[model samples]
Target: MNVQSNPVTASDTNARVLSYAEAIREAMAIAMQADPTVILMGEDIGVYGGAFQVTLDLIDRFGPERVMDTPISELGGAGVAVGAALTGLKPIFEFQFSDFAMLAMEQIVNQAAKLRYMLGGEAAVPVVFRMPSGSGTGAAAQHSQSIEAWFGHVPGLKVLQPSTPEDAKGMLLAALADPDPVMIFEHKLLYKTKGHVPEGSYLTPIGKALVRRTGSDLTIVAGSIMLHRALEAAEKLATDGINVEVIDLRSIRPIDRDTILTSVRKTGKLLVVYEGVKAYGVGAEISAMVAESDAFDYLDAPILRLGAADAPVPYNPDLERASVPQVDTIEAAARRLVRREV
Candidate 1:
């Protein structure tokens, strides 16, 4: 089944529509086929097909050596992946749940992030860490946190949060190509979302943002699932004469400040939305970027940020829905901003 109604064309051929998970698997397959040094290491990624089944059937294609499954210890697997990267192997490590990444902080934050800098740029750590992140699956507090901001805060590591199947496939390839360590936070709810994806290898440049919709009144900057909701909000606002511009922040770290500033400068108002908590989160940094730049002069309203409440995600579906910004909430916020009510 084609997931995208309007598939992007690559050259003269129409691109295939694929789900986010399928796109990611295709990217890994393409990379592994092209490079012998490329390897995949994660718990149950081989025989069990990974926790999310994103790595299903890879073991049969690449065999046990390249698609090696490790013990359930995230710390051990992450450390070994870093070691392999340091030794000239391109390793893609998958964490069952992003929350498990917290267990591997020492290796990711210290060793993976600082090794090249410590060695005077003499070595390259070409490692990609992929994990299922975000709330909406009733996974409760421990597993549903949107913690991309935590890694984005680090200097040397590059953090990505792709919102579409196309971006998911492209960004994964780009992450593998990078010389430094890259963290890819895949939202659990978005795994089934479909979009047009190219058949072969393609790189969606890191540190760039995509403008999902353009308008002249207010600009909405969002990442991951929030971007999708922002687009839906934009569509809803259009019927009421609120032309909202929506920017998809595909990459969290090294954010595309230029795109954001340009959009804000055009719209004269900015609303930053994220699934992460509002306090000191990704939106805070984005709001600061605009405030500190020349874009501040163009803002007709006080910059607003809509994010999840500063608390652990609850398991109850209704409570979970209330905790994070939804399409209606975004629409309400945009209307308030446009009407000069807030």
Candidate 2:
């Protein structure tokens, strides 16, 4: 994208507007400057500034050593990052696109997930993987996909999907501070989106969901770009007096069950939206969570799930848009469920 947003430094006084990429860059800079052990590893992250330019100007601020670019192999790079974490260095590895993570499943799912347990807590793997994920960029099937649910199913890894610039910076800092492996699924479409991000270092508490809008008629839960879509749908539905409540599901793996359950009980209706395919996706997990919990009794209607189409993401813009849930679709689904139409 080659956006030239100014870099965030500690000396800045007030909260400033920043793009999602700039915010992530600020978090990496802040973490690297604060801790010498913190380093960055990714393909073309140094001078090339990452595939989406999220790491732009980072190599200059921290030098090439701290912001080391690795070979083109995702598996090799991932294995090295995991080893770096075990050998007393905190490595933030960025995958050009999350779809490439499949090549490194052995390192991420096997080694990073089982080391501590296999040694009975004698060791820790504090690695952070920053992956640019989701559709809408016309990267087609090979590059456009939402795989947070894949890593979320793994026990030892923490999966986060921060939608706003504020949460993007804070949650990345939180992941850096965590003692286990963390996967941050940053949506490609959100890279240039802007929001107010506070100065200095901060941590958006891991595993906590934020109530974006409060209402009592229906509850809408989503993460990443889908969360923004849900919010937009909620706003439009508000004028019709639908009174939809929106929740930003910041952490996927360690889900904020209490927040979801509380909202479901208050609203009496639930709608889970996600960008992943309909079957075995995040929507299903959220639906099942409320269904299995005491919140089931509070449900005035059946929980509805709005997810991506089963077909691969198409290069055609119209087809790509049709494959994923959009604002209109989300609003329609929420309206139907709240009105007892299902």
Predicted model with the maximum TM-score:
1
List TM-score per model, in order.
0.97, 0.96
Off-target runs (Cα >4 Å) in candidate 1 are: 1-13
lDDT (10s digit) by residue, model 2, range 58-94: 9999999999999999999999999999999999999
Error of 2 at 256 (Å): 0.2
State the TM-score for model 1.
Answer: 0.97
